[model samples]
Target: MRQMRERLGTPRAAGVAGVLFALLMAAAIILVRLALPGGADGTEITVDAGQRGAVQTALELLPFAGISFLWFMGALREQAGAGEDRFVSTVFLGSGLVFVAMLFGCGAAAGTVLDDGQPPSAFGRHYAYTLLTTYGLRMAAVFVFTASTIGRRLGVWPRPLILLGYAVGLVLLVVGADMPWSELVFPGWALIVSLHILKGHRPTDHPSPTTP
Candidate 1:
């Protein structure tokens, strides 16, 4: 009974964590975009007082976002229980961690711009830019892919959600960086999935483990 209760409770916890992660991450991304328009070509944008404040705010939000994401990811893995495939879990865990590391690295590099109360140099922009756009999205794509596969095979998620995950993964892998405002898609998907889980995630009823 305790095990079953814990199992049932995981969805709500994961949902809350996911929602927090999604909101914080989306806010930080939006703030960063507003603060640094034109990607690395943001000398003018950086100089603007309003944009500078936006960047500062984003920096503050990132740590909390990372923490929440870890919680969300952990709860999600917990939902899979002990019988989850080691290989799939490995990929899922690796990709999620990499994505978080990239996010933190990006935040650290971007913080340098506010150090001297001046516009960021090209050096800082390199880390802030590529870490966020280049590698981060790639890792996100991998995470999405593995997550969708596991959910589909386990019957933890519905068909439409799994399909959407694949689509989101494709977008993030292919043109996430080049496409404007595409970063928001990840958090958006997270929010949707989290809500679904919270609404009625019945893992015990899946029957996948018992099927002959």
Candidate 2:
């Protein structure tokens, strides 16, 4: 009974964390994008106070977003425990950790603008978004793919959710960099998945994680 209660509690925890992560990440991305609409152009630039505050707020939210994502990931992994395939679990862990690292990397890169009290060079802006849309999205794709696989294997998620995960993962993997504001898709998908989990979409009957 205790074990069952623990399992029941995990989805709620994961859902709450995921929702928080989604909100923070999306806010940060939107703020940064709005403030620095230019993608790597080294064109002459000015950093007005409003622009500076927007970016500062965005950067400040990243650490909290990353922390929430870790919590969300941990809860999902706990629910998948014993049923998880070792190789995929490793990839899942790696992708998540790298994504978080990239988040910090981006914060540092963007921070240069505020640090020097001047507009960063074209290289700095390019480097920051490159880490985000390029590397970060790829890591996100890997994480989503693995999570979908785990959910499917454990029978914890329905077919539609699995399909949605795959579609979003593909988009992130392939077209994330080309599209403007494309990073929003990750948070959007996360919000959907979290809502599904929060709704208690999983089966009530017990099935061994190692069964299939």
Candidate 3:
């Protein structure tokens, strides 16, 4: 465990994970608070079934951001160790973990909101929509970042799904102008993270790292 901790980083994987988790938790808390019954005038209120689904959908999308974070972290881990597979493996592993974490969080939030009734309200639905859209932007950033990272590392390139994701992100930004254009910042982020990933490890005389 100690050895694994050392590999995580100077501050360590646990610390990094904690920070990421905290951010997610904070988002969750905000969602939960909003989901609670409240009126437009700040009085207690209730919502309908459709409103409940809308609220749940928005809140659930957020944890997906964690997926990208985890992926980068995993990449960091491999890059941390000394071996042939090194940085590339680290990136893929980290990236995969990020996605997995996102899936879990999304699932949990959805389940909680649906199964457990916490009297719905106009305030909660509105708040959830705001946060959900915010999360969509973050998820956009993650997908763009990951697609670029993988492309740069392996030169294998992004599949159609990735390109589709980028397009969707852009559309969301334009349509949801009220929200920040964090997704629009993806190209820049992709360029930066790609440089860092490339900087760390050079290609061997052989081929690049495979996904499997």
What are the RMSD figures for all models against the true structure?
A: 2.1, 2.0, 12.0
lDDT of residue 181 for candidate 2:
87
TM-score ranking of the models: 2, 1, 3
Q: Residue 24: error of model 1 in Å?
A: 0.3
Candidate 2 lDDT tens digits, 103-180: 999888887667546666567788999999999999999999999999998788999999999999999999988988
What would the per-residue lDDT of candidate 1 be over residues 1-212, giving only the tens digit for each residue? 34544665688888999999999999999998877776765545345667778889999999999999899888888877765789999999999999999999999998876755665777787778888888998999998898888888767898999999999999999997788888898899899989999897666644445446
Q: Which residue pairs show collisions in model 3?
A: 34-124, 67-98, 67-99, 70-94, 71-94, 71-95, 74-90, 74-94, 75-90, 75-91
**What's model 3's TM-score?**
0.34
What is the per-residue lDDT of model 3 for residues 4-52, given as tens digits with 9 covering 90 to 100?
3344233233234434543553454344445543312335444456556
Q: Candidate 1's error at 77, in angstroms?
A: 0.3
State which candidate has the highest lDDT: 2
- List where candidate 2 sits over 4 angstroms from the true fold: 1-5, 42-44, 209-212
Per-residue lDDT of 88 in model 2: 89
Clashing pairs in 1: none
